[model samples]
Structures are given as structure tokens and as C-alpha cells.
Target: MLSTRRLRPSKNKPKLPDGVRIYAMTDIHGCAHLLKQMLRVIDADLARSRPRYAIEVYMGDYVDRGPDSRSTLDILIDRSRRGNTIFLKGNHEVFLGNVLRDPSLLTDWLRVGGLYTLMSYGLAPSPTPGDEERQHLVQAFARAMPRQHLEFLRKLRLTFTCGDFFFVHAGVRPGVPLAEQQETDLLWIREEFLKSRQNFGKYIVHGHTPVRSPELLENRANIDTGAYATGNLTLMTMQGSSMLAV
Candidate 1:
């Protein structure tokens, strides 16, 4: 069953370009099955209400935690190549990149669900890998990863702005300019950005912290419903000044 809701209009409405519609999702966290379902749902929506222009924005964490990180990336990469799509970097993606360069980080990364990702790519990860084992695992991962997947990871954007909305993996710094936001804050910050009631110039759309349902606020919206564990993947729609979760 599909659940849909129209966001309550804020005092100062943020609108998209006329005749344009956006389908945005966040924090996939390796749930390929859920992602596939959401894509089908989006397709059905497009067929029902055709828009002049449609853009899909994925606020990342495409890998880690769940059963099929490799398949998740494959689907996303294919979708991006075939259509208008924007992929933002999430903290987990940063961790994955860092582990490739500094194998020592694998210990920490594994603690936060990196093992599932390794398994997805056909690598068996040791729970407590020493320096030599870590290095070996890194080499194995590099060999197993597809060239296109590496390219997709390397080319991921930290943020995307369209009309009156700013899309990112995590929330942005409250006072910092969007252009000046540090990668750390864009991919990881939580409390500071979430607690701020100040207007952020343009409305923000992000996902990092999970919630039971989409949190539609006056200044930002969080659409990560913890799909990796709960299976409640969220898809948000934006058109003109209207926002909907479908």
C-alpha cells in the first residue's frame, strides 16, 4: 500500500521551476529490494500524472547495513545513466572511500555495518582484521568492485540545488553558506542542523538520521525512514511549492 501526504505550506513557500517535478529518496542503506519497489512506485506515479520535466534526487547511503549493497549501487548507476538523476554522498560512502585508501579504517567501518557491504561484493570480511588482513581485504574489494561503481562513487556530488530547494545526504550547517559547507558537515552533521529553527535561505531536503516517518518541517524535510532495517523506504515528490510523500 502507498501512503501519500501533502506537506503543510510554510509561511514562505519554496517553489520548484514551473512544470518541473522532483522525485527524491534518501538513506537507502543497501536495501535493494526496497529501492526497486520505490522506483516502480515512482514510475507508476509518472505514468499517472505526467510532468513536463521530472528529476530524481537520491540523498545517499546507498551501501552498508543491509543485504545487497552491490546490487543497490548497480541499480542506482543504471538509473542515473538512463535519466535525470542526482546522487549525493552520504557518510557511509565516505567511509567506504576512506577504507580503500587507509585500510586501518576498516575496523571502524565494520562496526557500522561495512561487513554487509563486503559480503554484497563477494568479499568475506574478517571481524577483527589486523593490518595485513585489512590490506588484503582492501585489494580484494578493489578487484571485486566494478569500474562503473567506482566512477559513480567518485563522481557523487555533496549537494544539489534546484530552484528553491537544496538536496544533500545530511543536513547542512545552519549559518554556513551552501557553497561553503564542509564535506564533513554535509555528510555527517545532525544535532546542530536539526535543532536550528533559522531559515536556511532555501528549504533543505536531506537524509542521514532515521525517523519513523518523514519529518516535514518549516525549514527542512527528512525523508529517511530507516529502510535498511524497517523496510519503510520513503519517496518524496516536489512540484512548484507543493511537497508530497508517496
Candidate 2:
């Protein structure tokens, strides 16, 4: 995998030009190649659009369930640091953060398919890898992982607003302001948000509860299509309320 350590950025990441139209992505479960494909499409669209703007918000899941979590995080951080990407936290990141806090959580994470992340970071499960081997891979991956990658995961915003839209990793708790949204629901919600029929006031774009394609609900959209699992990536064009498959 391409090292992400070099891709990490320093403090005060630059902001995007919010006035321009945007294209968003979510639940990128470590499919590094698919992300490249998506970027190519975004570039083509940007080149053709009048006035030439770029993509904006992206929902997260940059790790786990795929072959190249390290590469995936590296690319997203690189693009966002370039000032045209907005990233929201997904449940996978939250789980990784938890594991970092308590390595014992590795079982829970492993149960949820986080072994790919451990492998990306150069760690192993049962009969933990030998020290020399572990240290070599760890140092290599650590050196390559962008520091901002962890910072990005650490300070990931649960909710953000751009124009009339509110973007989150997962849906908000019903009746809660974007300001008061619970982090748990933001990263892990599925049912309550899915079952709700009322308008959520501001339109929400999120990824969670994977589908074959973007699931367009009356109030929000699910951009997760389980790309890593199904070899399909779903995207929503911020240019308008439209879905694009890559």
C-alpha cells in the first residue's frame, strides 16, 4: 500500500469554496482503486462544468473491510488537505479510535471486520506477530501514515452544514438540532433515521447501512453501497440531487 504518513498534513487545514457546487462520497471501505476512479470522474465533471469548480463534502469509512485501508485513508487525507475535500466521520473510524484507546477492543473491532485495519497498520490478531517483524511494519506504516490522518479521525466533525444541506456520516436523532446530535447516532445510526418519514428540515447526506446504490429517502440519502464488499461505489453529485455510480 502507498504510505499515508507522507500524506498527513499540518494544522489549520484549508477550507473549501462553499459557494461552488459539490460532489460527495461516503462509506469508502478501503477500496483505494475505486476512489481513484471516483476522483477521475470528479475531475472530468469539474473540467466540463462552467466556471470550473471542484468537489466538496465526503462521508467517511476510509478503513476496514477492503484490501487497502491505509491507501484509502492516505488518499482522502491528501485530497482534503488540498482544500477541496470535506470529510465526515463514519463508524469505522470511531471503532478504530476506540481500539487505539483500548487495544483490548481489538476483539470487538476484529469481530466487525477491522482486521484489515490492523493488517494495514501492521498488527496481527492471535499469536501476535513477532516483535521484530511487528516493529518493522509498524515503523514503515507509521512513517507513511499522514499525522493528519489520525487528527482527521480524532477531530472528525459529526455534523456540518454547507448551504442548505447538512452532511453527516450517519443520520441524526429525530428532533435534535444538528448542534445537539449524538455522536453515537451520527456514526452508527440506521433504523430510527431510516424509518422516519418527517422532513429533517435541512437535507442530510450520509453513509451507513450499505445498499446496492445510493438510497434516496425523502429527507436524506445513503451513499454507502458497500463498495468494498460489492465492488461498486455510489456518489451523490452536489451539483444537484442526483446519484452517480462509479
Highest-lDDT candidate: 1
What are the runs in model 1 whose C-alpha is more than 4 Å off? none
TM-score of 2: 0.81
- What lDDT score goes with residue 246 in model 2? 42
Worst 10 residues of 1 by lDDT: 1-10
Clashing pairs in 2: 4-144, 4-145, 4-146, 5-144, 5-145, 5-146, 8-146
Please write out the lDDT profile of model 2 over residues 23-111, one tens digit for every residue.
Answer: 88888888899899888777776778753565567787878888788888878777877786777788888887776565555556767
Provide C-alpha RMSD values for all models, in order.
Answer: 1.0, 8.8
Model 2, global lDDT: 0.70
Q: Please give, for residues 16-122, the per-residue lDDT of candidate 1 as tens digits.
A: 99999999999898999999999999899889989999999999899999999999999998898767999999999999999999998999999999999999999
Error of 2 at 88 (Å): 0.9
Per-model TM-score on C-alpha atoms? 0.97, 0.81
Tell me the lDDT of model 2 at 80.
74
